[model samples]
Target: MNFFPNFANINECLEWVKRKDLALAKMELICQLLNHPEKKQKTIHIAGTNGKGSTVAFLTSIFQNSGLQVGTFTSPHLDDWNERIKVNGISITNHEFFLISQQIMSELEGKVQPTIFEFLTAVALYYFAEIKPVDLVIYEVGVGGKYDATNVISPLVCGITNIDYDHLNYLGNTLTDIAQKKAGIIKKDIPCFTTETKPQILSLLQKISQEKQSKLCKISPAKKFIFDSSQLITNFCLTAKKHTFNLKTKMLGQHQIKNASLAVNMVLYLQKYFPQITQSSIEKGIKEAFWPSRMELISQEPLIFLDGAHNLGGIKSLIQTLKTFFPAKKPIFLISIMKDKQVDKILNTLKKIACQIIFTEIPETRRQEISKLKHNNTAKFHKITDYSKAFFSFYSLLDNQKIGIICGSLHFTALIKREFLMNLNEKLNNFSLSNHQPV
Candidate 1:
């Protein structure tokens, strides 16, 4: 085994973004060479078109509250690459990431060339299994579950958040086709849970689970929901496995209620293995768990929100949340989407609630051109090549009567979030300095 030539730093590892052919054989071979790190921990595998990250966050917080060591692996990090791997809500340090990468690359000895995600998956498995072992590990599927890099793990429990039309290029376009692909995580006699309620999709999932001899728990939406607009919290009651549990969460939108319910059900199902998780931990965890860039309120004075609603389904949910929370008021939207996404449908959906739209470019090759984002709608549209300039231009127009939302691609939202936080901090610092009198 030899170290990958010229791989000096973590950035070098992060630069391998080219996605290779989607197949499990390569990842299986890599795991075998690494001595089966995937099988060394209690695991829960999650796959879906959306809500995967939120469900993972809810589960992580729940297990942590139970006083168990929990490790989580999620994707499309908002800020740094290390965010993809975490133990007890703490990301892996860059030094640790580099060391692990070096070890895995040396072991492979150039015999196997893994995509960026594959390499990162290997790193996460090794880190959890050998370096920093935990009581349980939760894995989020990178793409469709059938061939996703994370599918190699035989998890104790599996969950599919919901089936929708996403990643149409790789997964099929129809809902049934997509549902089958996501249902791939179900293993023999392992209980699977989902929040998907569509009859057709549920039937397909039921068929697949029956074939695998797995019990598919179909979670219904909350029986009742109450939202506190002033505090931005939701309280709901959910019944699963003939037991009813009351849950509350800070994550906004009607969709999050379903996500939180699914997490609760999965945790309850796993109590046989982890009996330390009590109702108190589940309630506390649901209340405290938070994931950024999903209906996040960055500012309340001018009412600014940032959401990563890139697809049509997500955009529809965003629209619903806007209507429910701020009815009859149109908010200005700042949006940039990936080229591969259904740009027209997403823009059209946003138009339903947007008083104005500012189209900006994300700092990536995959971003749709600002010109293509324009649509003929009543809402005033402006195209700005630079996102910072676009944001400032939009900010100048906001007042108590006007609100703003930054959305579209998660990558774009991440960049804007950093800029917004930095700008806000600067303003606060200046305000404090002006108010101080040498005290």
Candidate 2:
């Protein structure tokens, strides 16, 4: 795994914008030019508004522990491009990324320009085929699965987690509309799994599956999960079928149980083809799987947490999770969101749990500048100009007995994490932060 890619010095990686161009035609051309590298491995395509990353993490850990070489392609890297394309849990090395990137550049240099997402998807597929092949590829849909760049692959199994309002402009405005976009990944005769319970959304997905001749296997959680919450870890006694499994995860939200349940059923369905994946492996893999920046508690003494709850539904979950853990108090929150997101809904949802809120923008063009926001959270709202200072204030308040949480876009979470980490390495004489406590 490489810390930084070779093109880190170049501006192409970060400067490439991911806009509203959603279609498979462009990706089809790029893959044809690259000789169709996506056919290298069998795939299980996972798509959802929230829990896609965590679900991917659970499946990756389970398959890898079963002794299978797993290749996972996820989107919106928290740190860098290398974080997006990974093989067997290791990020594609800078050399590997550079090699594939050059090949892509040569093939589509001037003949046809590719979008950032398209170029990266081509690089990942090429890397998987020509560079290093794997047994399975746990591919996550970038945004709406309908015409996402990664939707080019024909997967063996398609899984759609619970769908809600998200990507309203690109996917659709209503839940049914969004569900249709995610169901686009269901291929002809492929088996599908889902945790979607909404009647309308479920009906839409089932209809798509039937039209495609695919089997939509919906996995419903037990009547309820028995939660065991300690100081830091949260465990759930999840019962599926006659057997009960003690599932443990570092994630804070109860929604993870549903995600884990979906992963469990998918592994079970794959048993005929993959005899190595067993019940014990599933239990161990899920317990150990950790997806960063999603309910991630970085420190305890000052009690700072980070969750990438970028949308209304995600924010609601974050609030509920906090209520479950810290029943009686409000946590100080530092948030940054995109300009295009539903600002009012997100803020209203947070008013219940956020004692004090600081709104700041990551240094990006799409960031929701503090001045550009139209929010209605009645809490003690403070808008800060500098993101670093916002994070600094949140950290400085750790010792005051109020908990801290960072939420909103994953990219904003990434920037704040990077800034805080960078602040840790500086000399105390130059600047001070949270009394410099170690996790």
Candidate 3:
């Protein structure tokens, strides 16, 4: 009878997840919002078990480099909710986000209240439409692609980065079932692209593409030419339309290079259709795009690195990149994970490379209990309940010569970054007062 609260803030939305079942409820709300007169513009829909965020970032940068104003929507913001919505790499300001939330709340006053993700996706679409300069929009599906709210966009091009076991409870238990859900983003008569596919997923893609009469472009990493890898750069190129031009990127990881190639191919598809995207623009965009928490180096003293490799596939890539980038020795790690994730797989992998493990929880209801993490061998483990304390404890144990890795979840990385910045500011202020350096 009453909806007075109407989603006050992101914290409220985070709390709402605890009460609702994650499957199909938000999808229905997205459909309702799509039926409204406010929706506009064709989107580039992306889905996968890994590399979705990085792929979206690459595409957004490419479009922007070609001088088209672009809007991008992504999920599970690493450092800020504002990171979820951006125009040309600038986050939507807090005031802007609040206004959009208020307008959506007002619109749903008498109707069914939309879920947080549904409301946010609607707000992003409405904002991008209302803004005059936006020429292209890239929407990253919040969950599995099939019923993801962003699927309402009817994208011009669809891309699946990689298929792996993830979100099994909500999507499906088997790989084929998961691939089928991801393939849902492939629209009728739209071009679809993929990178490094499995035989099972490729079969699903072939079936869906045939049914929709869509063109499917499958990419194999081994088939492509890769030159080099470093801490700051990843370089590679793919054969598209019979060209092997150089493709250099700032993002880390060989897997990311594959994602970049997929994005590059999408731009090529747009070029064939739109006739405006130049090879130069694609190169510039790929070189400039950045997604936080994927092989991000936040500190140099102790060589602190943060990655959001929450899934097994991503975790494998993260480990490979770690070895390739830092080949000297094993590093200390501060790790946390979601309660629903494959914790044992990750822990087993980590035990092999981590010299010491500091277990902490991200500030979320979905966080797994650190105490519950099963250890393969009785190696060193420190359980710190709070992220800030965990970070501090981990930092104290590290010397200037050691490398520190903080990973497991994107939210954990974001929380640690915020707290680390805050602590640095406080220490600077205290130093200034103690030395009487400023008035």
Best-fitting candidate, measured by TM-score? 1
Instruction: State the lDDT of candidate 3 residue by residue for 1-439, as single tens digits.
Output: 2322379898898788765545545544544544442356757888999999999988988888888878889998876778888888888888888886787677667666677887888878767876433777889988888777777777788999988988888888888898888888887899899994678779889999999899888875523434353336666666677766477776777788788888888888887555678888888888889888887878766677788889888888988877876677568888888988888888778777777888888768889986676653244766778776677667766666567888888888877777674466574354443443110
Q: Considering TM-score, where higher is better, how would the candidates rank from best to worst?
A: 1, 2, 3
> Candidate 2's residue-wise lDDT over 377-406, tens digit each?
343777777776777666665554577889
Higher-TM-score candidate of 1 and 3:
1
Alpha-carbon runs more than 4 Å astray in model 1: 1-22, 374-379, 425-439
**Candidate 2: misplaced stretches above 4 Å?**
1-22, 226-228, 241-243, 375-379, 399-401, 421-429, 432-439
TM agreement with the true structure for every prediction: 0.90, 0.89, 0.85
TM-score, cand. 2: 0.89
lDDT of each: 0.86, 0.80, 0.77
TM-score attained by model 3: 0.85
Better of 1 and 2 by lDDT: 1
Q: Model 3: clashing residue pairs? A: none
Q: Evaluate residue 326 in candidate 2 and report its C-alpha lDDT on the 0 to 100 scale.
A: 73
lDDT of 1 by residue, 99-217 (tens): 99999999888689999999999999999998999999999999989889999999999999988878899998888888878888888989999988888989999999999999998
